[model samples]
Target: MAVRKIEHVGVMVTDMERSIAFYRDVLGLETLGTLDHGNGTIKLAFLGSPGAGETQLELVQGYTGRLAEEGKVHHIAFTVDDLDAEIARIAKLDVTFIDPDITVLPNGARYRFFYGPDGEWLELFQPA
Candidate 1:
């Protein structure tokens, strides 16, 4: 079995439109596409990266039953060229944030989280 590169990261959001705005407008990530997976069971939105498709964010919604509450996922972080710039961009949307600025680590990388709708944590970090 050949494993492929991560196509996108799946995030569970209680509110699709609000989360879309948070990721698209606030973060400046371009929208690639969105799809309704029939019977109102699932909704998906694909977000493109600054480099015009280097990465993506798959926004998933409308699924109930486990993993909807706390402790399921602590956070989901996306790598950025300039963590500071991305942080500032999202801050404009006034999306609730944790450590609004980049926090330095001993390894020389930085990180921060912008709390999303329904407590879905969104993270921006620079990898070493």
Candidate 2:
């Protein structure tokens, strides 16, 4: 059978509040709500843009430190209508860009990388 689109990306976060703020406030994603599992041993916050069936970013608590490593998932990317506008908005949050400047791929698509509150790699991609 053919596979459907990704439902969400599960991210392990060190600080639930900060991670939620980053995804909800900084990125401007809507909070779908939170979940308590394992009798409160685990906490998860679901976030996504406004609109039905959008892929969500799930932030899970109960982990310490970063989980991303080389040769791993690398980064989660989000599409932006205006990369420059998005960059300016994110700059107010004091987020550091991994690249000195946006990179243009061979196909002419533009992208830049940054880190989330829990040091999770994230990318902003603009199609050609």
Candidate 3:
């Protein structure tokens, strides 16, 4: 199978407005659209920074009945001209990063791990 690109990352939050405010207002991300999944009281807000989905952070509310895992996500993302610089910027955010150094994945990709507010595992890497 050939994959074009990652659509976006999904985050399950307890409060929709709060999450949106944190990301959209505080983080300065732009909201693309929102999906209201009525099966439950879940809603998905698609957002993008200047980099678009290459750095999209989705806010999903009322799903999973729990928050995302704390470390080592099911999917990891890596996008940057300089990984080290990006890491440094993220570090300044007062975020709790798991590993600030480069990591070797089983597929032989180099990555770094960080944790999101809701316990989401984020992997930042540069393609070989």
Candidate 4:
């Protein structure tokens, strides 16, 4: 009930710089910024059209070098007004959560990962 919209779609990439360049140069999207995950092993870059309230494309690196059969599309993120409320609400559902606790990024954005019915990755994100 807390979800507002589809926030962003995460795409797994082997090279952050190259992926940023491709999204920027080829797709006409601007590089919003990049962040190093608290986990230390993962790097993330966000790209989107140069405007506010636009859906973004998140480039994720260092998750796993070997791509899975599901392909590079890592996860779908949904914007939530109240992450905690959504977490509590979703906990009653049958879906499985991938993260035990919410992850707060350096920029203050918070997120929690869960799984869809078909095992696809899903994220509930509250932006800073």
Clashes of 3: 1
The list of candidate 1 runs beyond 4 A from truth reads 66-128
Distance from true location, Cα of 113 in model 2, Å: 28
Residue-pair clashes per candidate: 0, 0, 1, 0
The better-scoring model by lDDT among 3 and 4 is 4
Residue 35's C-alpha lDDT in candidate 3? 62
Clashing pairs in 4: none
Instruction: For candidate 3, write residues 1-128 as lDDT tens digits.
Output: 12234545656677878888888778799887676654647676768885655656767676454433652123345455556677778789997778746865333445576887876676666544
- State residue 67's C-alpha deviation in candidate 3, in Å: 3.8
Whole-model lDDT values for every prediction: 0.69, 0.72, 0.63, 0.89
How does each model score on TM-score? 0.49, 0.49, 0.48, 0.93
lDDT of 2 by residue, 37-89 (tens): 54577786878997865677878787444654552344576777677878878
Best by lDDT: 4
lDDT by residue (18-89, candidate 4, tens digit) is 888888889889888888997778999998887865689999898756776677899999999999999989
Off by over 4 Å in 2: 64-128
